[model samples]
Target: MAAVETVRGLVELTRPVNVIAASVLTFIGSFVAGGVTAYPLQTGAAVAATGLAVGAGNAINDYFDREIDRINQPERAIPRGAVSPRGALVFSVVLFAMAVGFAVTLPVVAIAIAGINLLALVAYTEYFKGLPGLGNALVAYLVGSTFLFGAAAVGEVGPAVVLAVLAAIATLTREIVKDVEDLEGDLEEGLNTLPIAVGERRALVIATGLLAVGVAASPIPYLLGYFGAAYLVVVVPADAIMLYGVARSFDDPTAGQVQLKYGMFLAALAFIIGRGALEFGGV
Candidate 1:
């Protein structure tokens, strides 16, 4: 039981849920680029590689944010003394190596992308994370690249670019909202995050504007005929939810943040369903 608890703590240090989500996005990218049957091995490798990279990034983030998290999230592994900072760093390096190993098995494009993303993840945590807007953009780019990485794994990158753009916008909005939610702790830590640099209200406005842009662009895929009517059916509601979340942020940043998270997940689901429906005739 003690050993199991230790293992669980280590896993939690990596933010397993977020890693799983990244893996799912990678698979969705693969599905969007070409059906699963077309690139099963490449898709599987991409999912594994992306998940590991995300997990490593989270672990390193926790290591760097140990002090901030001690105040904002004491229950986290490092803050709770379940994992030491050095141990977490070492674990993260190992995970990054494994991710790169998996990526090297795929096409050269996947290898190149994996290398660049890994560096970006480190740079974000070490330097950019304290800068206003730049940090948010870097994180958003990483999220968006998961789809591109998937497409690259199979040597198909055309349509995935559109999806990547949508993902980046949605992620940027959510990251800003999260900064707003963590403003108090971040300010105390001397982190110049968006909310800290510009007051929370102003940050909320920026986030809302970004969300609006994403909502407006949500229909582009369908209009471009990349996706069918089923995409519109699900994506329309997803966009509406995001818009409502943006409105709610004016009054309640935390609640709006939660809503945006759910909205992004729903939007990704809509993409999968829409694409599947078009390709498999209602999968």
Candidate 2:
């Protein structure tokens, strides 16, 4: 019973779903770039590395933010006493080392990207996270790189990269909404999130504009003859759902739960559509 509880606590602390999401996007991006010639083994290993990096990053963030989280999110594992800060930090280190090992199984590029991912997570947790727009952009860049990492692995950059970038924009847009959701907690901690710094109304407007751009940009590849029509057909509704989520958030900014889920859906749709189109189009 003690071991099972400990395992569950660690699993919750690591945020496995978020890690898996990164891995899935990375794998899909690699598949799209490589087309039919994609190496499943290489892609799987890269995804595993990405997942480990993401999990480790989360743990590190929890360790560093334990104090802040005590006030802002007392239910978090460390703050709730389910895990100690030192234990979390050690767990992060182990996961990061495992991620590096996994990265070495692939090309040098994967290793480099894995390092970048870890660094970005650290920077975000330590400093960037308090800097309003900058933090949001950093998160988006890291998310977008998963796709670019896939492309680099296969020695190609194509429509998949564009789609991934658009997906990142959508993610950034939703992150702003998340900031609004946490405005009270952030303000208590002196964290300068966009909603707090720019005012919630202005932040909402910016989020709306960004999401619009993301939706419009997502289908560009198909429009430009870079991908099959099916790509647009699949992504359009997903983008529409994202837009709806953003719009709804305007009514209740604390409803980030909706936006976050919608963002995840958008990413999943992008991956699925990108992969299906690339595979069936014979590109």
Candidate 3:
């Protein structure tokens, strides 16, 4: 049981939920780029590669953030002594290798994306994380690129770029909000996150501004005829939720974070459903 618990802790350290979410984005990208039946095997491979990459990235981030986690996330694997830093590093490297191996089986574009993402993940955790807006933007790009990687796997990017852009904007907003939430620990660790560099209030304003941009842009695909009414049905509500979150951030950054997180998920769902509806002649 002790060993099982340790294994579970190690898995949890990789943020499995986030990995799964990213994998879902990969599938959504494949579906949007070519439809559900297009390049099924390639889609599966992209999902696996994305999951591995995100999991590896999460582990490496935890390894680097062990000291900060000791204060901000005591229950984390490293902070709780469930995994050693060296062990986590090894785990991350192994996962990254597997991800790259999978990527190589796909097209050259996928391999290139995987390589770039791997380097970006390492750089973000090791160095860029200390820089305020730049770190957030890098993370946003990483998140958005998952869709592009999926499209690349299918040999075409198609309309998935719209989804990628939307995801990037929403993620950037959330990353900034998270920075605000972690301000105290970040300051203690001598990290100059946006909240610390520009003041919490300014950070909130910036986050809200980003969220507003995402909300405004959410309907672009439908208006451009890439999607349909079903897209509006779901995306409008998603936008409303994000807009509300942005408004609430002025008073409660924590609550705003929760709202944005849920809103982002809803927005992703909207993309999937909208695309499905169009493909199936639903709306």
Candidate 4:
């Protein structure tokens, strides 16, 4: 029983859901680039690298955040005494090493993206997370880069660029809202988050404005003839939900951020559907 609990704790630190979700984003990016079947090796490498990287990132983040987790996330693996900080660090390092092994097999551009992502993931929690808007921006860029990484693996990065931008914008908005939600804990940690620097309301306003740009530009893929009308069928509702989430951030940052994630997930689904339409029927 004790061994099982420890195993679960280790797995929890990896946040498997996020790992899988990010991997799917990579796969979607490859699919949009029409590389899924054509460049099977590269696509597989990109997807596998993304999953391992995300898992490593999450574990390392938890390690770095253990102290803060006591205040902000009491039930987290380390905070709950389920995993030691050193153990988490070691786990993350192993995963990062494996991710690198997979990444080196990809195209030059994909390899570069993976290298940058690996460095960024390692540096984010320690060097960047405390720097007011910079932390949020770093997280956003990392999220977006996954799309580009996938496309680069297939040798056609144009279609995935748009998806990357959209994902980044949405991620930025959600990160801000999350900062707002964690104001008290962040303050206690002496972290200079966006909400701490600009004030929660102002940070939320900025997030809203940024997301507006993303929402407005959501139609670019279909407009550029990369996707079809079916894309809008899914994206419109996603945009609406995201808009609502940002608006609601003013009242309930936690709820807003959670709802915003659902919107982002929907948007990713839209990307898959839209690209499928283009690839299968050109509809």
lDDT against the true structure, per candidate, is 0.88, 0.77, 0.88, 0.92
In model 4, the runs with Cα more than 4 Å from the true position are none
| Model 3 lDDT-worst window of ten | 29-38
Give each model a TM-score.
Answer: 0.97, 0.91, 0.97, 0.98
Best candidate per TM-score, number? 4
lDDT of 2 by residue, 1-283 (tens): 7667656767877898888778877876787676326577777777878888888888988887787888778988888777878888888899889988878776676667767877898889789989989999988888888886766666565646686787688778878988888887788888888999889989989999988887777767666655666666667677777777888887886574475565556656655665577657643
lDDT value for model 4? 0.92
TM-score of 2: 0.91
Per-residue alpha-carbon lDDT of candidate 3 for residues 1-283, written as tens digits (9 for 90 to 100): 7688679878997898899899999988888887448688888889999999999999999999999999999999888888889989999999999998888888888889889999999899789998989999999999999889988899988688888999999999988988888888899999999889989899888888887888888888887666778988999889888888867877787898889888888888998888888878857
Prediction RMSDs, each to the true structure: 1.4, 2.1, 1.2, 0.8
lDDT of 1 by residue, 1-283 (tens): 7667667777997788799889998898888888467889999999999999999999999989999998899999889878888989999999999998899999998889899999998888789999999999999999999999998999898778889999999999989988888888888899999888888889888988888888888888887767778998898888888888877877787898788878888999988988888787843
Per-residue alpha-carbon lDDT of candidate 4 for residues 1-283, written as tens digits (9 for 90 to 100)? 7778778988999899999889999999999899999999999999999999999999999999988989999998899888889989999999999999999988899999999999999999999999998989999999999999999999999989989999999999999999999999899999999889989889999999999999999999999987878899999999999999999989999889988999999999999899888778778
In terms of lDDT, the best-performing candidate is: 4
Give the runs in model 2 whose Cα sits over 4 Å from its true position. Answer: 35-37, 281-283
Model 1 gets an lDDT of: 0.88
Find the 10 residues in a row with the least total lDDT in model 4: 1-10
Stretches of model 3 off by over 4 angstroms after superposition: none
lDDT winner, 3 or 4: 4
